[model samples]
Target: MKKTIYLIIIVMIILSWNIAYGEDLNLSGESYVLIDAETGRVLYERNAHKKMPMASTTKIMTALVALENGKLDDKIAAKGECIGVEGSSIYLREGEVLSLKDMLYGLMLRSGNDSSVAIANYIGGSLEGFVSLMNKKAQSIGAINTNFANPHGLHDDSHYSTAYDLALITKEAFSYEEFGNIVKSKSYTADREENNYFYNKNKTLWEYNGGDGVKTGYTMRSGRCLVSSATRNGMHLIAVSLNASNWFNDNYKLLDYGFNNYNRQFVYDSNQFIKKIYVLNGNKEYLNLVTENSLFYPFKEGERENIKLSIDVPDTIEAPIEKGDKIGYIYTYLDGKLIHEGSLIAKSTIKRINKFESIINKFKFK
Candidate 1:
């Protein structure tokens, strides 16, 4: 027989349509999305999957590819291709040198077109090669709708991404601690002698509470784009806007809606003991089991009442059990729909009792 356990823990799945939990927001973006960074759940969105030019938000992917492939402390020289790039720039002169770390500060904080090229050329061996890396990274991280034509978010008819895709990219970029630190900094001073000072262009870091990231973008072709993130009350949220005249206010409302209507709830910890099961012939009479992974998910108010948990394992097992052995599984469900599943494992090894010990114990009872 299967043993089933039910508990009132928070649970839910990503909604298929706009959920009617908070006030309707008058967001200005042609395409926009707000997501729970911890669970990758979409809280709110409009035209979020429609492909459109994302402007300088493209740098998020650029920085992710470079950080994964290159070292931060290595000094990289600006190549001739990095000179005279259009739009925002830190104004790199050919052969001018800056650490890869400093160049990333320029790429994200200053929105430097030149910095993007410099980092790309050095890390990927060429601009074309680096753009390829960005696309590959995007696809690897499940941002299948994203494409990269250049290191900088310059207008290319072929270059475009969806609001949802941008949010995914930003979430992946934020996974790197250095990436978070760079985007959140108000200003940075490069090791180079001239044009060393750079100030962050993303004003969300200053104007909004708990806003620590991310990037801002504007181009005549792409309009104004912004990808922003905030952490409040132990919840981290990512908001993306494409071609919005009021992106700052739009994102602010979107984030407010999420923070106000939802909360991050802990569901399971890998170290937490699940249950004890009888061991048929072990030296110990029983063996403890624990979850194999931790789980946290965002839940709306009242959803906790519907949460349920189930476990599947043998009622009793033979001895010689090993630690970390996958004995069964724990499944979490909400409203009868499965939301999360975790592995159940033995917490410690249990050796079988020898026949001589068993015979002696019987004699002692007699």
Candidate 2:
């Protein structure tokens, strides 16, 4: 009995160790998180819930609220108030005029403080109003740990965000085509009235493959900060790092882990045959249902065997169905737990049966 108890204790220790360090993870940062943009699922994390100074990443939220509330094509006149706002500038001259779109390019790509203020003033009539909008937008998007004291992300003691909240905000920003386009740009030239041009300040665009536009920051108090995004194959991952000693290396390492260990595979393609379902009193006895878009899943290496696919389809769907109508659902499972779901849509319309055929079908059912 003594020997058996000793062996059981040894086994429990081994099991606990395996559970604690089994994910092939190595990371260093005060707060960090990698997330899938499409699904908003956290792939890896370290201290992700701890709120810290986010530095220039605050511009992401500023840009988002500005774009959502203000028109892109509207002209913005650079006022004296925008001058000397401090830290990263597109060098806007007083009284200079540019479209809101050009200024955003300047703001996001160049990380321009002046442009940030210009946008804030143009959209909200004052910086305080714009900051209020930023905070409101953050709350609405589930960024519970975020607060915006200024539009440019200047280091204010009150301004802070958690890794998880930054990821959430970025995922929301990615939904805007304008935001996505601006961030991915490696270089953008903003022309002033006299043919003066300013180039983008983000250096990662030139350094990494699929390194689209995001933001980077460094302050005496905030250390080095970066919000980077990349797409390879069909997978797009967003990485947020705050107060890291090595921003670039940490981001690259996190991105490499994501791409190397996980895969985005198409479980189902649009208009492809999922299965056939029976139809009642319809012109066609059977109808084909398929996905409208390719369903992508991120699976760990060698873990595909653990994944399962299941389809939930209704029997005898009613007639007069419209094409592309949702008819069923396809679920992807891991270890018998559903991880993802895609809609199964009708491949083509199913018309109602003629009166004679309907009568015959009714009699057959009886």
Candidate 3:
């Protein structure tokens, strides 16, 4: 009986340890990173800051800028510069016209260099003007290490971005509804006068489950560059790979590792009851408090218990308090280090005592 109990206890300890740490993946890429889309938490990364040419993946920003600022229905005349510029093309004929939306699909799905130049000229009024917009957007989105020389990711000594910076750019782009629709599409049928059809160049969209977005790029200098996003179990993940030969395989590996190992656990649901806060000189002596928003943090399985939750409240607050008044905060910590925090708010209003009560107290008090 003693031996059996000891064995059970030992087994439990081992199981607990296993839950706290996830398996490490052998990701194949020159530089790569995986991040939580919602929290911007880095799940895994390797040499993510090494600047390298990104090839046509540069079109992601081009598509994003045009979608956000340019009118979709506006007809843009294809210029001479849009024809036979370099790299890939959707075969935009000189003097042909395409809607802003069609140009986007062509720019993204087909990696059309011609579409990029035409859109840039139409939206920015010049290629130089549009490149400035791309750089500005990159800076605004915390992509500090990125620079763009052209709307398309052509090989230029100065055209470069890091894996991490590209990940940040991809996240910013995903916030737009139309950007999401375009990147995730497998194919696009353009309503051009010539009738155009373009299929997505990002193969992970069809090959991997839950695979949605992003872009792919290739150049002799850039090698193979790819950014991809996926959703699983209510969690969204973005991955970037630069100068990698096995870009698609690496994305799959990183995503599977992220989805299987990490999970977002809600520490406190919105309006969940916490503790009653004392209210001095009010109709009620105390008011119940609760968290204002859902509080969540990522934790590996059995590590949930390691998260310490604490509440801070004043001794007592004067009344006439509103229902949503903040009285305290509940904070979560890991090994005494801060992890996440949420506001503790009053659940109900506490009105001040009547004037008659104040007068009676003043007369009766010794």
Best by the lDDT measure: 1
Ten consecutive residues with minimal summed lDDT in candidate 2? 18-27
lDDT, residue 192, candidate 1:
81
Best by TM-score: 1
Question: Where does candidate 3 stray beyond 4 Å?
Answer: 1-24, 270-296, 308-366
Clashing pairs in 1: none
**Across residues 1-366, which tens digit of lDDT does each residue of candidate 1 receive?**
122222222122223222432225767789999999877889888888899999999999999999999899989988888999998999998888889999999999999999999999998899999998998998998999888999899999999999999999999888899999999999999988888999999999999999999999999999999999999988999999999999899899999988998999888887679899987767777789899999888899988778898999889989899999999899999889888878999999988888887676466545
Better model by lDDT: candidate 1 vs candidate 3: 1
Model 2 global lDDT (CA atoms, 0 to 1): 0.83
Ranking by TM-score: 1, 2, 3
The alpha-carbon deviation from the true structure for residue 331 of candidate 3, after best TM-score superposition, in angstroms, is 5.9
Question: Would you list the clashing residue pairs of candidate 3?
Answer: none
lDDT of 3 by residue, 1-366 (tens): 999999999988877654332224545578888888876777878778888899988988898789778988989999888899888888998889889989999988989999999999998999999999999999988889999999998889999999898888888888888888998999999986664989999988999899998899999999998999998777889999888788998889888878888997767799999898666767776789898998666667887888888999887888899999988999888778886677999999878877787566455542
lDDT of each: 0.89, 0.83, 0.86
Task: Provide the clashing-pair count of each candidate structure.
Answer: 0, 2, 0
Q: Which residue runs does candidate 1 get wrong by more than 4 Å?
A: 1-23, 276-287, 311-329, 350-366
- Stretches of candidate 2 off by over 4 Å are 1-28, 69-71, 124-129, 132-141, 156-158, 193-196, 353-357, 361-366
Per-model TM values vs. the true structure: 0.85, 0.82, 0.76
Candidates 1 and 3 compared by TM-score, better number: 1
